[model samples]
Target: MSALTGTTRLARLVLRRDRIRLAIWILGTPLLGYALAGSVASIYPGQEARLGYATTSASSLVARAFNGPIHGTDLGAVVVAETYVTLALIVALLSTFAVTRHTRQNEETGRAELLGANVVGRYAPLTAALLVIVAANTLAAVLLAVALAGAGLPLAGSVAAAAAIGGVGVAFTAIAAVTAQLSVTARGANALAAATVGLAFVLRAAGDVLGEQSADGTRVRSAWPSWISPLGWGNQVRAFDGERWWVLALPVALLLVGVALAYALAERRDQGAGLIAPRRGPATAAPRLLSPAGLAWRMQRGTLLGWAVGVAVLGFSMGIAGDEFNDMIDANPAAAEAINAMGGGADLINAYLAAMLGLFALTIGAYVVQALLRVRGDEADGVLEAALATAVSRTRWLGTQVLAATLGAVALLLVAGVTTGLGYGIVTGDPLGQAVELGGAALLRLPALLVIAGVVTAIFGLLPRWSVVLSWTALLVFLLLGQLGAVLELPQAALNVSPYTHVPAVPAVDPAALPLVVLAAVAAALLAVGVAAFRHRDVPS
Candidate 1:
């Protein structure tokens, strides 16, 4: 058979395997973008209102850093600026992780070896994975365009915005492919790809914030800094301003160049090996690696640290912008109402801080779930079997992962609270009190987060194959309910299904102690049942 033979067939197989996953990625992201755009347009209906909001947002460095640079005063531009950067970040990260996992990860685990032995081409797996990502991202772009245009945005701008998002995904997919060839393991590839995107975001944010300030009292309007980042290039397309379509060429060129480089590297590397070979560690395992708990910590510590740093930075930046909301509330009554709904308080800064903390808490919950799911990963890798061969009991093995996850959750909550409180307190002149108050507020949400982690553990015990999907699906439902339910005006009964809805807004509002206690009790019970079930079941072959 030819070296490129069966590539198209493998591509088709991959599409069939990933049909639901692709749909979720493509539909979920654009739907979110469209919803946010429509809501912003409605909230600031008039041109005057849009202009006022834009001017206010521009002054907040945190806002400018998270969102891209605001262009014109139109509602469309404001929506694009506020929403597209985030959307692109999400899409690109998802695409990269998905592609790298199915391609290089499978190869590293020997699954691709089994498949490759059956008439597959040398490069078919990588090619097929890239094709799947491209197709999914293309669908996302088309759907996003339609959704935005249908929401009353101009056709050209909407399409350009969608194309920009797709370009970002394509660029990252190629980057992931290249990293996959360089790293020996899936975790390494994921880390490198994620870090690249994160660094790009930070750079783009720094460049945008700095570029926004007047140097020597003269405003700089050049797109130079933005042009250096893929994300910035997307923003420079100026979707709602004059429709700078030529900017799309940059990401396209980068994607092509990245893919070519990846393929060339692939030809140089051997199957199941990386361009950069794994570095050998100590000849003997560390004393800490003797226990399952220590092993779990060893595996997850890097990821937790990365998340903590991101959360801390995000909290600190948002904290610095607290004072800006004071001015914003005075200028815009509608914005004030939105802030009030998030956390009912007379002090707009406190309310904003409360809302930001709540959002960060949910992210902390996601990290907790991923950490706890290391049990599933261990089971799949046959590591659990090897450990079981020793004197270690199943319960003990499971307990190690669960304990690590719980502690990691607490660590993340502390990091977020301390960072946010320190930043806000220093500016407001009440350092110690604010830190204690915010830290306590973050702690209150832990019960709900633990409850979700317990649910994942229970699913893994009872239905191993369905565990990851169900857990992730639960997260998606929570996200939609928490974010979109308010916008769609959904019933309180439906909204209350999410655990986050139960965590009372802190610092601004009085704590609801009963709900927090109940959540904790539920978490403990679920964990008990899951561990018991795991003890009774035979490990899947």
Candidate 2:
């Protein structure tokens, strides 16, 4: 039999397994750009507004660091500038997760071994996964092009923008493939691949921030750092301003090299093992590992720590940007007005801080879902069932996960709040005071995070089969409503459905007591119902 035997059948099986997931990535990735395209007209209406945006954004280090360099004054260029980094990150994530799920995860679960006993080739699973991701990225690119064109952008620039996004996806698919070959566990592969994506973003940001501004102050020529990142290559495509078709060659080359390296490395390693072996663990279990709570903590602590570090970085960066907001507002009053509208406070600095805090809340909410889903994984893998056979009760097992998730989220918030305050306070010469105030603001976001946790727990108990998909869908809906509701011009009634919509933008305005109380009580009810249901229902044997 040929080495590539049964590849097509494995590809079909992957498609069948991940249909919903693929659909979400393909559709949702494009929709983000379309929504931003539709809103850009209102956000920056005329040429003057667009020019103002280009100039201000191009000149602001904070803007450049976060969004990349602005290309030109055209509305299409503005759309690319606004959405490129965000959409590229999403696409990259979609690619990594899809690849790792089908390859490393399959190996970890012994599915690949079972298939290997048949006529399946050594590279069949990896090949099938990459093919699926390529198809998904192609469909997303086409749909995104159509969406942007429908939003009134020129067709050619839209296609270029879509292609840029797709390139990032392709490049990261290769990166994940390599990481899959290198890491023994699926989680380690995912983390390694994701950290690479994060590194790309940072490199792109650094390049843009350190680059030279153009004569009109509406464009920046990025430094050498950008040339090394896939994101930088995508940005260099310059979707609207003189679309550089050649820059795409970089990612295509990276994809080829990465895939070749992956396959070669795979041949050297034994099946279900990685080139980089995991560190040896202690022979005996720790005393803490005796309980369900302890086991859950051991499984989840690494994830929590990763999130905490990321939050700290974000908070500190935003805190430092706090000092820059005044200069940004002074240079462009129109932009200041936009910030005020989004943040809802008269004081520009406070408004900016409040907006950053909301972002912190969203991050915490996502972390909560991820942590809870790990518990779902335990249940799905029958690990929870084994634990239950012992003296451990169902409530203690499920409740421990919930409690750990809650406390972990709280710790992240505290990290975010303090780091943000510390960063700002150091710049303003009042570190202690700012830390206290910002830390409180971060804590205020806890109720919304809890509401999200409760919903996920309830789903886990009531609809275990749909728990993963439904939980993510819920979080995505909340993110859309909370972040884009105003931009999308949705009705207040519709926006009210998100728990985050009720959380007051603290420091911007004094928060009312009633909304926080209502959200907390609702969260409590959901947690109670979920726990009760899990106790009574039969575990999926």
Candidate 3:
């Protein structure tokens, strides 16, 4: 058989392994697009309202940088410009991670070694992964097209929009295939791919912002910087405006080039190894590594640092944007109602900051859960058994993981608060107090965040097999209720399911001590129950 043979069989294997993930990516992307479209349709129902939104969005440097360059005055065009970049980013990131994980990560973990000993060809795994990602992207495109068209968008525009979004996934999947060859570890490969995606976003934002003429008193050109990023290229496709189909050619061409380079590099490297190998550590273990908590800290510290940095960046950016937000509200009367609806008045900026922090806290909660679950994962992988055979007790082992989760979440929230405060202080010229206050506000949400981690732990202890799904399901429900319940006209009881709802919107509104205390109490109870159950149950065989 040829070196490239059995690609089809490998593709089937990839699909089997990633069935749930593929379903989530394929279905989630378009569903989110449809929901956003529905939201826009509701929020700006009239042409005049849509035009005003378009005008404001186009005028705002931050908005354009985050979204894409506005193409036309039409409502459809406005929606396309506002929503496409975000959707494309999600799709691209998913595809890139999917490809990298299945290809390089599997190989690194030794799963590919067993497969390779079979009929699998040299390039079969990579090719299969690409095919699976491509298929998933295509499904997303089809679903998006149908969803948009069902929502009464012009069929041609819908098709174009879907294609543009899918094209982004295809492009990034190929890029990740290349990165996979270069990086030695799965984490490094994933990071490289994610960084590339972030760079593309930044470049696209720069190009869009620089190329546009400032609608306000400033003189900024908006379209030039967008030309720099693949995301920009996708947006420039302008799904609704006169259909610039050729814009897709850029991503497609780059994908092909990336695949070729990755293939060549793959051939040059040894199986199960990257061009770069991990650096060796000291022969003796550090004194800190000897402790259960220290080992947990070592394993989770890098992830916590990364999360903290991301939250800080987000917080800082939102803070800087606060001034712009106020300026925009002052400049546009139409936006006043929308701003008021989001959070009332001159303090709206603070409200926005609080809401952003709350949402990020949810993500940090997920991070904490995953970190804690690393202990469960270790047990499943037999790593915990070996450790337990050593000097560690069940209490000490589990306590280390839980402590890491709890502490990590708190650290992340503090980072976000401090970053926001610093940025707000810089803009408003009150550096010291804002940072302190915002940081305090961020801390108030900790009870709710911890409650989420506790819930995950309880599930992990009581129903280990279903823990991850249950945890994520709870998060999804909470997110849906907190974010969309009002728009969807859901009931108050339903909205209250999210612990976030109880945490008073800080900075804008005074912190409500009652809810914070209640959440903390519930968190403590859940943790106790989880630990008790864990003590009683036998570790899984």
Candidate 4:
């Protein structure tokens, strides 16, 4: 049989299996662009306002680092600038997860071996996965273009913007295809791809921040670093301005090179093996392996460290940008009102910090869910059964996992708070005072984070099979509600459903002890119910 004998059939299978998940990424990603376009149009309705934004943002290194270089002062160009970096990053992740889910995940679970016993060929799975992901990216591009135009952006700019977003996604899809062949397991493949994406963003951001700006402060010619990254190429497309269609050739070239490399690597590796083999563990178990808590910590420490670094970077960026943002807000009342809605205080700087901190809470919520879901991963892998055969009780094993997750969450928050304060303090020459204040404000978010942990645990206990999908979905819903509830003008009842809504917007509003107490009680109750339910459920193995 040919190496790609079953590519078509396998592609169909991938779509059938991942329809809902793919649908969410495809539809939801573009929806964010649509929302941002509408919000930007409303905020900067006039040419003068757009120019003001261009001038202020162009001169601010922090703004340029976050948003990339400004293309033009037009409404369409502004929308592209606002949404491209974030949307491209999102869709890039979408591609990675999709590729790894179909390729490495199938191999890890032995489904690939089972299929290979039949009519499937050697290269069929990889080819099929790539085909499906490419198709999905194409569909996402079309939808994003339509969404942008529907939001009243120019058609040409909208198409350019969508192509950039989709180009980044496709480029990353190829990267993931290669990473899948390099890693032994799906998790490793995803982590490698994610790290690559992070590097791309940093490169793009660095290039933009270091680039020279025009005399009018409306355009920047990015440095060489931007030219090397796919994200940078996407940005260089200059959507809604001159629209450099040739810039897109860069990603297309990378995609071709990456695909060829992935196929070559695949041929070198044995089935179910990787080009980069996992290191051998010591012959003996460490003493820490004896305890459930220790094992839990060992399992989760790496993820915690990764997230801690992410939040620290976030906090530092926010801190450095705080004072400048206050001035920006003062200059733009419409933007100020939106920022204030997150959690405004008498001090505009404090308000900005509070709003950013609240956003961080949503981000940390994702980590919380992922950490807690380690329990589900263990259960799915049938490792729980082996561990349970020893002296460990179900409750202890599960509770230890929860404890690890909680402590990790706390550490992440503390790190964020301290780093934010540190960055601001370094700028203001009052590090200690700012660290204490921002650190405290960051800790104030703990109750809301705990609620998310409880929710994930509950889902794992009650619906083991659905735990992964449901847990992430729950987090996404909470995130949307927390970030956009006010912007969307949803009802008070709907907003209150998100635990983040109940948390005091620290520094912006005074902390209320009662609400904190109530949230804690709710979290405790959920944890108890989840633990109790998990104790009664059958181990799926």
RMSD of each: 2.3, 1.4, 2.8, 1.5
Model 3, range 420-441, lDDT digits (tens) per residue? 8888889899977988998998
Report the error of model 2 at residue 7, Å.
Answer: 1.2
Query: Is 2 or 3 the stronger prediction by lDDT?
Result: 2
Question: Considering summed lDDT, which 10 consecutive residues are worst modelled in model 2?
Answer: 330-339
Candidate 4 wrongly placed segments (more than 4 Å): none
RMSD of 3: 2.8
TM-score to true structure, per model? 0.95, 0.97, 0.91, 0.97
Off by over 4 Å in 2: 331-334
TM-score of candidate 2 versus the correct structure, residues matched by position = 0.97
| lDDT tens digits, residue span 1-541, model 4 | 9999999999999999988888888898778788878878877888877887888788889988889888879998888777788888888988998999999999999999998999988889999999999889989999999999999988998999999999998999999999999999999999999999999999999999999999878888899899988899888999988899998887788888988999899889899999898989999998998999888888888888899988999799889887687667766776776777777667667777888888888888888888888788788888999999999998998989888888988898888889898888888899899999989998999999888888888888898888887888888888778877776678989998899988888888898999899999999988988999999999978
- lDDT ranking, best first: 2, 4, 1, 3
The 0-to-1 C-alpha lDDT of every candidate, in the order given, reads 0.81, 0.88, 0.79, 0.87
Q: Write the per-residue lDDT of candidate 1 for residues 296-356, one digit (tens) a residue.
A: 8898889899999999998877776776777777767767666666655677777788788
How many collisions per candidate? 0, 0, 14, 0
